[model samples]
Target: MKKDLRFLVVDDFSTMRRIVKNLLHDLGYANVQEADDGKTALPLLQAEPFDVLITDWNMPGMPGLDLLKAVRSDPKLAKMPVLMLTAEAKRDQIVEAAKAGVNGYVIKPFTAQVLAEKLEKILAPAA
Candidate 1:
């Protein structure tokens, strides 16, 4: 289902970024890009088209919550599906992300199966 999808992975850690990229690749999404932080991700978002966004909540520059808000508020990218992959499991944080229009959420150290399930659900064909 993800063969034609484009994914943007945002994280402060290069290792984490590579992990997400590898997961996306293993899931059959070959077209994946990486950003070290929300600041970098924003420009990439503006210059390219990504079908889905998987971002970490905490970063040095712009937090993922703010990035989520920005993406949702932007007319051109507002409808893009976003999945928050973060270590922040706080109830309020989750609530905020949901309110910001995140399509899915996953706590850190999650299984690839769980990620795949969320992606499949979010990208399911409209009946």
Candidate 2:
């Protein structure tokens, strides 16, 4: 995975976003943008090119699942990688995310190592 890839980290709580952003930074991904919710994230995604999206499942507005669906539905953004970094841990919700086209999923209260591994797995070129 490239260190310079652009990343968007979306979460309703500013603290979570900050934590994720800091983790990404520590992982050498400095080009990270933040949005408070999917409603805010979708517009930024539509406006610019983001290499990866790390989103929380619950939010005040459009949730991460809807954002993932919208991204998958958009011709321009369909292929962009999405990682659901959330607290939602139900098996059904994980399955739903897979069905909706999320490239990766990481439960909340995650470690920097876990985040790095998921990102690397998703961004790795297939052999």
Candidate 3:
């Protein structure tokens, strides 16, 4: 199931985008796209369907939280799952993301194992 899923990696930093993309690739999800910020991600997500969104909170154009809200509000995209991968680890921010419908939260400087675990939880139902 993971192999068939498509993903979008959104972050202002090219390095972070590459890191997430590579990690997704390593996990066998090769059909992934990159976006610089929430603004860019909004258009791409609307134009195409993505199984999951991995975004960074602090960005220049539109922030990740805004993106999550927009995605959830849009009828066409409301069902898409979002996972935040950012340095913003505050409880309030996490709670806000949860309210906005984020499926997972991963703090930055995280390990590959951590990312994998989150993905598994979102993509695979527990037995």
Candidate 4:
């Protein structure tokens, strides 16, 4: 069921974005989109109906936390599941993301298996 769900992956680095996209592809999720930063992602989120969001915490213009807050505040996008994949492993950051309504958290550098597990856990009920 999750194989067809649209996913938006936001990150500052192109290499990281490609890596995540490839991992998603390996996990059987081919409908994935990429954004260089939260600012770029916001417009896409507002304009499209994405089932899931995978974002990095640190980004230029707007950070993932702010993006999560924005999504949560918008009635149209509030219910979409969000997974935060970032290098920020601090407890406070994780707590902040949780408070901001992120559905899952993954600390980098992560394995494809770990990413698959996180995606499965987040998308399981919907599937």
- On lDDT, the candidate that comes out on top is 4
Q: Which ranges of candidate 4 are over 4 A from the true structure?
A: none
In model 1, which regions exceed 4 Å deviation? none
Per-candidate TM equals: 0.95, 0.96, 0.95, 0.97
Residue-level lDDT of model 3, residues 65-85, one tens digit each, is 999999999999997878899
Best by TM-score: 4
Candidate 3 weakest lDDT stretch, 10 residues: 118-127
lDDT of each: 0.90, 0.92, 0.91, 0.93
Off by over 4 Å in 3: 125-127
Candidate 2 per-residue lDDT over residues 23-86, each given as its tens digit: 8899888999999999999999999989889999988889999999999999999998899999
Ranking by TM-score: 4, 2, 1, 3
Q: Give the better candidate number (1 or 4) by TM-score.
A: 4
Deviation from native of the Cα of residue 25 in model 1, angstroms: 1.1
RMSD of each: 1.4, 1.5, 1.7, 0.8
Q: Name the better of 2 and 3 by TM-score.
A: 2
Give the per-residue Cα lDDT of candidate 4 at 30.
92
Query: lDDT value for candidate 2?
Result: 0.92
Which ranges in model 2 have alpha carbons more than 4 Å from their true place? Answer: none
